[model samples]
Target: MPKLLITGIAGGLGRLVAKMARSRWEVIGVDRDPWPSAPDGVVVHQFDMRKRRFEDVFRTERPEAVVHLAFVRHFRSDPATRHEINVEGTKHLLEHCAEYGVRQLVVVSSSYVYGALANNARYMNEEHPLNASRTFPEIRDLCEVEGLVGTFLWRYPEIATSILRPVNTLGHSVHNAIGNYMKIQMVPTVMGFNPMMQFMHAEDLAEAVNVALEKKVRGVYNVAGPGAVPLKRALEEIGRPYFSIPDTVAHTLINTLFSLGIYRFPPGAIDFIKYPCTISDKRFRQATGFRARHTLAEIFASVAP
Candidate 1:
């Protein structure tokens, strides 16, 4: 079996991907956090990707492929370190991949990169420009990482790089912004704005990654679950009661609470509830014949409090 290295193997989605990939590839895991419950055959190392010891894994193990999942998602702490791990860490990772001759790379990005805009297409394609920072500037590092990976994809076609922009992910283990928001009591909504949303189970996303790696999918593609739903419907499906308010009041209250460490997401996240940022996964589905297996009901069930 070819060797595959998974960064952020301690994470929920990362662990799932590792389990799914282990059958076909000898899996090596890397993360700053420890994974004591790692699968029997997999060897996990605790190493910060931005540090010197991280490169040692590549030099020693020489993985044939890599799944880049190491990122600071919640952005509530040390902004500087978060930037280093997300943006600067990716820079070094790309350099290492090039130097180490890794044959394939799979980067898991978020559909939020498309940005929730009032004028957004019902379903954005890969060609759509990433303008997420226009409102949600907090995730600029994610955009920067994707930009770096996007450039690397073209600059090193021999590497067979693929970037997946998956919709909001929710599961029993993963804690994404959407999941955190929906899990809260009395979730807030922008008045008269019921944006469409796309959600997928973390397991389905893990399978998507497996298919991309298996088929060596190259280029950027959007990944989605079976269907899209209105924000109201999504909240209802998850048994989350949301109260609608004017955008001004909603943003202010959320930001204030966030500053006091009461809210999980930033104020800019209001745009997502106010505007749709759904994406079409036709390109990915066409390229690898990958279909999300989890139903919307299952996806919501995993996030229900």
Candidate 2:
């Protein structure tokens, strides 16, 4: 069986990817922290990419492909380190992958690269240019990661790369992030009037990664849920109430809470709440032949208990 290396196996998405690929591939999971449990065929390595060199691990494993999910999702602790891991870490990973002659590389990226704007309403295709100016620090940093992948793909055509831009993904055992408040019956803060939002199940995203690895599809693809709906409707679908909050008030409260160490938000996470983020997955679906079996209702149903 071909070998596959998955970074950050301690994460929800990383675990899902390992489980999805275990039956077919020899899976090796690398993470800084110890993972609770690994899939049957997975070998978890307690490795920190920040302090340790990953090239040694790559050469030892000699993976046929890689699923890069390691990232700094939060920037509160160390802004410089966040950029180092997300941006520089990616550069390091890509250079090593190219050197080792890895066949395909699957990079998981967020949709925030598009920026927070209503004009991004249309299903954003892979060809769409990322918004260069983003106010949020974390969003700007993530945008750098996306840009790095684009550059990597252009520079190294020999190594096939599939960049998946998934909207809000929720699943059991994973941190729900924005969708969690709705699950608790609290008024989910809406930035403005009804704004359409789309999301995917983490398991589905894992399956899509598997397909990408197997097919070696090169290029960027937007992978979202069935369709887009108003944020209020999404809250209702998940059995939660929605409350409109003024942007000024919300931002003030959010900043205040963070300053007091009461609550913290990723740089761009709040901006996302204020705007609609909808992407077109037509090309992604057609290419991977992937379908989301679980609906928002099913996901919420499992969480309700």
Candidate 3:
């Protein structure tokens, strides 16, 4: 079997992707977090990707394919630390892939890269500029990482580099910003605005990654779930009640909560609920024939409290 190296294999989404890959490839994983007693055929190395030792994995394992998922997305750590882990860490990984003769690379980016601006299109495409950092500078690391990967895609045409910007991901295990925001008690929203939001089941995302690797897809694409729903409807589907605050005071209020560690999302993210950042997966679906199988109910249940 061909060797496949999966970064962030300790994560829930990583495990799901790894589960789907082990049967087809010799799966090797590297993560700063430990996955004790990993299953057979999946060798998980525990360490930071930025560490000098990471290069050794690429040199020794020489994986033909690579799946990048090692971002510090949950925001549990400090911003400086997250930036180093996400942006700087990915720089090392890309260098390793180019130096180690890897043939394929799949970068799991986010649809949120196209900021939830008031002027955003109904279903933005891959060509849409990434403005996420314009307002939500807190998550600029993600945008920067995507930019780096996109540039690498063009620089190293020899490697089949695929960048998948999946919409908000929801699952029982995987932790995402949207999922975290939805899990809040009395999920807060700015009054007079209920933006259309897109979500994909965790398993569906794992399958998307599988298709990208199996097809050796190159270039950028957006991945979506069954469809879009209003922010209120998503909460209603999950049986979670939400409260609306005046838009005037929403930012300050949310910012205070975030500083106090009571809110999962920061004030900059409040604009998401106010504006639409929904995406079109036409390019991805047309290329890969991948249709998300999970229903809205199934997606909501995964994140239900």
Candidate 4:
């Protein structure tokens, strides 16, 4: 079995992926927090990706492939720190990969890079230009991160870079924005506005990452489910009530509540409301011959349970 190194193993999706990968590969995981348990046959290492010394850990492990997932995940709270970890830390990892001759890397990215919203007709293929104007700070940071990773590939064509851009990953992890909303019963289904929603189960993402490792494809690809379900329909399927407040009202209400410190939304949550961002998985399907096995309904059901 080839050795594999996965960052952010302490995260919900990382833990799930480590559990699945350990059965076949010699899985090694790294994260800032100490992993609570080693999940049977895997090795977990603790390290902050933001530090200069993080490269030393990568050098010592020298795994055959890497799956990078560690990130600050929020830009509004602190733009500087978000860039430090998401972009600088990614550069650290890629620098080490290039130095050590690591052949394959699958870095998790987001569809927010595509921008606020386009007409539903746009399939969001891999060729779409990354969103500009710094529309949302979170995506603005991702645009930087993605460009940095792409540059690494450009510099070293021999090394393959696989970018997985998944939209609205719904899974059992409480850390995910949408999943957390569902957990706290805070997600309000808008009746009048039903934006196209695309999601993948956590298990499927892990499996897809594993497949990326095996296929060794080079270039950017969108990894999402087949169909785009409406947000209202998605909430209804999850057994949640739908309330479609008018566009003006919804914005005012959320902004007012947030101003009072009564609640907090994800960094790009509000911008996404109007954009209805959705991505296509056709490129990934053609590259790796992989398809999402679970439906949004099934994944939401698991998360709710």
Per-candidate TM-score against the hidden true structure = 0.97, 0.91, 0.96, 0.90
Task: Estimate the lDDT of model 2.
Answer: 0.77
Compose the digit string of candidate 3's lDDT tens values, residues 160-200.
Answer: 99999999899998977788888888888789999889989
Return whichever of 3 and 4 wins on TM-score: 3
CA RMSD (A), model 2: 2.1
Tens digits of per-residue lDDT for model 2, 167-212: 8787776664554545555674755467677777778778889988
**Model 2 bad stretches (over 4 Å):** 179-185, 259-261, 266-268
**Candidates' RMSD to native:** 1.3, 2.1, 1.4, 2.4
Task: Give the clash total for candidate 3.
Answer: 0
Pairs of residues at least 3 apart in sequence or in different chains that clash in candidate 2: none
lDDT by residue for model 1 over 1-305, one digit each (tens)? 99999999999999999999999999999998999989899999987787788899999999999999988888677778888888998999999999999999999989998899999999999999898998888888899999999899989989989999999999998877777888879987889999888899999999999999999999998999988899899999999898999978887888899888876578878888889899999999999999888999999888887
Report the Cα lDDT for residue 53, model 2. Answer: 57
lDDT tens per residue, model 4, 1-305: 87788889899878877887786788988898888777766888787877765777667777888889887664345557777778888888888898876888889887768876545335678787776335555457778888889888788888888888887777766376666655555566433566777778888888888888778988888888646777666676777654555666676777787566566553346656556677778888998999989886787686663
Better of 3 and 4 by lDDT: 3
Cα lDDT listed for each candidate: 0.90, 0.77, 0.91, 0.75
